[model samples]
Target: MTLTRRSFIAATSAATGLIATPAILRAQGKLALRMGHPHPESDSWQDVALWMNETLNEQSNGEITLQVFPNGLLGNDPTMINSVRAGSLDIALTGNPFFTSLAPELNVLDLPFLFRDRDHVARVLDGEIGDRLRRNFDGTGLHALAVWETGWRHVTNSRRPVVEPADIKGLKIRTTPNPAHIEAFRLLGAVPTPMAFTELFTALEMGAVDGQENPTTLILNSRFYEAQKYLSLTQHAFTASPLVTNADKLAAMGEDQRNLLIATAQEGAKRQRAMNAEREQSSLEALKAEGMEAVEAPDREAFRAIVAGPVQATFAAEFGSDLIDQINAA
Candidate 1:
């Protein structure tokens, strides 16, 4: 039988009760892991982290313990990533775009307008493209456990509704220090300011940055809408976060333990995607209730056209024209 969302939830609920099953306890010993992400405890990323912790603990019969540090408790994404690389941290869930700084070839995933939707993103990442990206981590001292999708990113600002490319003119938009993002917003006529995720709320509230772009789930969870009144449904980019582990730590685990971890992470990814989709659909209502003016602009195509040229020029040499052609075709 096909597992609908309801069935999946029911199955997970049933599985939760099996936490103390003897069979799970015999295969995997008690293990503790520290995982970090920059978002707050209320964010979907944190929710997924908790889900992974619960699922792993249950599946391993309380043998595996996951401690999650949310809200940049272990520093920012880059810092957490470096910590994992150095083996100071056991695991992390981080944005894929940031990986571009470490492995430039991975930047192919960051290509603007590359993903048409969630299904398209999944197809590429779960297929050959994902395997190749995983191989890039082989010598980097880290293991890519799973790639999970974050919802499509949109724009939120205190400035005004962004109906067209020109509407963003002169707005200082806070972006992750990812070059692709900076360039994409620059093409949209905004002065894209790269800032750490921790600094964004203050930046928005203090008027240091006039706006920022993120998915609906993030904006709502981060409470950015409380400070910024305008939300533009640009859906300009779709994002993924990698569930990573210290290579040595993963290598030390027995084959059964390793398989369990990967399987639990995959389940966590599935749960996260479903939770994000549900939150995205309902979040607008919450935002509206909070007095934020949500605008659905009709000119997404115009914004896409503006960034297409710059994205191609920026990564044409690395991605090659053929791959770009294929992604665009899809």
Candidate 2:
């Protein structure tokens, strides 16, 4: 019997039999998981969220459902995270840095030059290191379902093209509320201002921030080009956005439902990563058409060197020397 993905899922559901629908599973009383992210509905993050909703619902035969709140509708990343911890929010898809305040070990993934490329990021994430990070979330009142890459970050601004570290001097850049990201731009000579993703477009349009750094897909998906002109391919950090659920809510699920949720999340993550990569490739052309100067071959190593030492020192105490060595070796 050739078992396809859909067939395998159906078979597994049959094996689990007709499980009693928890009161929370009723149509009127369905447990609605509120997932928050900073991207609009058109973004890749939303694509993944929709996929999870569809897959999880089908797998559980409508017993589990997800309600997505996109474009920071619930609040900024930090606010959303706090809500999740407090059990007010059910789930969220957010950058790892937001959770660093809770789990410092996650900072290892934020090191400026740690990942040589996308493949390295995936290898480490899908390997023991990723498992270790997931394990660390056990007692944090949250459960990490999967880690998905957002591609390498690049700098986009209305100022002059950034080809070297010195060019970024005095430029006001908006960054996520991550210490490492703030320090990175500060070390590169830009004044990094931490802000919510939803506020970025307005901040740029109003000249509140000279530029910001994000992946190509983000720059295009968020229509950052409407407010910025120059894009520097610094490729500084490869961000991992984890799909996290409240531990209490997750713990209440049956074994079959739990397994299905995790499986669906993993599958959704794969789809998200592929969509992000595809968007990254085509975003340059889209930006160019929009009259944005896409700067290429910028001295990435020069910028990397600026933040390398400080970021390493900041995280060395948490990740310890061995894991850092493993990432460096990779």
Candidate 3:
């Protein structure tokens, strides 16, 4: 399930059988495009973005050139999303949970323990539920091309190990500004504090927050191990990042180029998800080597049993029982 960057690019290039240098594309009306995300350069998504850029450049015979912005250099999720909507930026890859601020329907995905694992996530996001979520972007002036992965989220803290639901009580935990997640954590007896990822390490180091939750890729790449001593494999929720673009911008690209972008992005997401799944164990081991202890086993059912009723009730009232039920049934 693991794929190296070089091998990914080689496979994409070989599959397309269409190759051209950037210089050649520049001569043939190259369209300069840009995509941004919040993760550091080491994130699998970043590599996939770069891979998509190169594939598009060659696939379009240099008619399309994509520039990638990593580490929030372009902007955070909200900022980049606004820029893309304004047509000032080309594309973005961000978690759907964050998009709830704009489109509340996205909250359905952030529900705790909503997805069993990566395959379940893929099943939910690749089926009708996924299509409906993608189309929901139109109201926000964005077009979603493919839904990507951020893997499952786990907990890390500087205080002590978290192996039981009671162990989390009174601890200030960091979370994205999603109501469902915040409410879920609150129901778990933890004080949920929403903040930007860029400020997380300093927050943890300064004791601004006791712990945070994120995927293994982010925990390792962002070096959260330096400030947090313990990691619990909670796998409470999986993050789905939609690779999107401005609706108007996509329309202007014409049929062929637009299709190529979508195709390359989907392929890139496939490889990126594979790379993340492959890296989970190695990344955890690396974190341990770097001095962070892993609470390898936790009582998932206990955690779920406490939060399930309240979260599901809240989601049903806000998003309708049918929507939540559909996701569970899927």
Positional deviation of 162 in candidate 3, in angstroms?
Answer: 0.2
Instruction: Looking at model 1, report the run of 10 residues with the lowest lDDT sum.
Output: 18-27
**lDDT by residue for model 3 (1-330), tens:** 333445344434442232122211223556777677888778888788878877997998878877666777666778878877777677888887778888888888888888876777887888888888777887788888888888899999989899999999999999999888899899988999998776788899999999999987789999999899999999988888888888876887768888998899888878988999999999999999999989989998999998877887887887788877888787
TM-score of candidate 1 versus the correct structure, residues matched by position: 0.88
1-330 per-residue lDDT for model 1 (tens digits): 432333334434543343233212223357767777887666777777777877787887878867677777667888889888887778888788767777776776776777888888877777776787778888888898998766788888897888888888889998877777888888878899987787889999999999998888888888998789998898888888888888887888878779999988887887888788888968878888898888776488898899967887788866677666655655
Name the best candidate (by TM-score): 3
Better of 2 and 3 by TM-score: 3
Give the per-residue lDDT digits (tens) of candidate 2, residues 1-330.
422334334423532232122213335534545566877667788777767887777877777776666777667888877777777777778888788878878878887877887778877888887898888788888899888766788999997999999999999999877778887888888999988787889999999999998888888888999999999889898889888888887888677877888888888888888888878868888888989998889998888778988888877765567888887666
Counted clashes in each candidate structure: 0, 0, 1
Flag clash pairs in model 2: none
Q: After superposition, how far is residue 92 of candidate 2 from its true place, in Å?
A: 0.3
What CA root-mean-square deviation does each model show from the true structure?
Answer: 7.0, 7.3, 6.1
Model 3 — which ten-residue stretch has the worst lDDT? 16-25
True lDDT of residue 268, candidate 1: 81
